[model samples]
Target: MKRAAMVVNPIKIKDMRLLHREVEQVMRRHGWAAPVWHETTIEDPGFGQTQQAISDQVDLVVALGGDGTVRNVSTTLLGSGIPLAILPAGTGNLLARNLGLPIRNRKVALRAALAGRDRAIDTLFVEIDTTGDGVADESAICTVMTGCGLDAEIMASTSERLKARAGWLAYPIAGLRHINARRTPMRIALDDNDFEDERPLTTVLVGNCGRLTGGVRLMPDAEPDDGVLDVLELSAERASWAPLITQVLSASTRTTSQVRHRTAESIRIECEEPTRVEIDGEVHEHALAVRISIKPKSLVVRVPRSSKPS
Candidate 1:
């Protein structure tokens, strides 16, 4: 019998009771035999709870929330070699989509969690290097993408109330509000190459996986276990409403030729002024510089066996 635990965010979606029932039914079907459950509190994220579950020797840990919740679990189980399963209760189920997991029905997600195939996926470690002590201040493991600049600002400015009502579409409204803001120049160094850009950037994203919610393909070539990170620099010059509209049109066809893409083992970003950073859609305070690296095959996640592309 495989012992499993769930770290769920109770406030994610409107149908909490139904979600719980589905999860319980799936566990019974798989003969999990009374699995443990932990609810994530505002004070302590799912990561801390997941750590406790691992310490309790659970064979599998499931994250029952959105992208932020999944990221927290990923950080906790980075090197513990524990496999993670997702119950996509969040607005933007980016990581779940990347894994080719079903998200339309809670029962399907739960069944996949209970009896799905496992695949090794790469995770990104993002660290902020402070100026005063030259020491890193904060760091986290992200399964999807990390970004700074305008996109981060949009994430920061988006109100929880709006998110509760509008879900993932709330981002676009916030993005439009900040579209005309002046761009800040930044210095970018990827692997061994260095470049400077003067245009105000809307967002600079680094992705480990290609699929994003809403069918947006920010990094179409990104592969989760490829041992490399895909970097995308979106400047206001290129990311304006017109270009963005064009990209959205192209993304409908699964084409990313309108967007910029680069792949590297690591990346360094610096700006003349402080910039906000968002990892997996959760915003962080201003930072002068951030270093990101790929932890190849650091996580094992459940995916559909028939979902793998040939």
Candidate 2:
């Protein structure tokens, strides 16, 4: 029987024992051996466990957490030729939603993953500079969206307690509290200065795939394996997100002074003041600037063989 590594976040799961038994039943029915499970910890989320999976030479790795868990697992699995499967267990299962994978159903996701058909997707390599000195204080690989400004603030301000109780609704609650926050003055350069702009922006989102938690298509044209990133720069001067959200929801490409969308292979963002940045759903150390580059076809992800990916 083939082996699999299950990297799970216990906090995201409701009942560990029952979940284990359920997973075992699926493995047995599918002719896969009982999986070697590795639980994610507060100190070490999914990196160490995913690395272990690679060392163990498992047939595939299943990530059973939220976007953060999937991001961490995929970062380590990138370029390893190991296929990754995600079971939506977080507040924003953006990747699974974007890929049309089974959402919030671990059994179905695991079974589909085990069945076959994996796709190669792109990943972002980000270097964040905290000191404004132009040196990267931290670097990591991320799949899905990463950005600064309002999005990061909302992610940071959201209470885990409320998130546990309300799920995606918690983000809207946090957003309402932060709706009046000030925008940051920044300069954005795309493709090594192929195009550049300066403005006070509320949020700058770069997505490998476009689709946020609330069914808002932040970047309507983003494709994970398209070998580029979609950039959305939003600005609102009057402490109002109404106009900005309206523009996004309507899918208008008529760039207003407040909303701009572009496609790039690499991007550099420098802000006048320190800013919080969110990669996937977790907020990272405040950064003065960030540099992001796309790695084409870097990660292989499990998907339904016959289903058309979103």
Strongest candidate by TM-score: 2
Q: Taking the tens digit of each residue's C-alpha lDDT, what string does model 1 give over 1-310?
A: 7788889998875776766677777788888866688989999878689989999999889898889999998889888888999888887888888878888787787787777788899999999865634567988888998988887898899998988899889988888788677777777888777755544555778889877657777676788999999888765553556965667446432324335567899998886688889999998886788889999999999877666421
lDDT tens per residue, model 2, 230-288: 99988886646678778888877669878989999999999888899998887986789
lDDT of candidate 1 vs native? 0.80
Clash count, one per candidate:
1, 0
What is the Cα-based lDDT of residue 207 in candidate 2? 87
What pairs collide in candidate 2?
none
TM-scores across all candidates? 0.91, 0.96
For each candidate in the order shown, give its overall lDDT on alpha carbons. Answer: 0.80, 0.88
Where does model 2 exceed 4 Å of error?
194-197, 308-310
lDDT: worst 10-residue window of model 2: 191-200
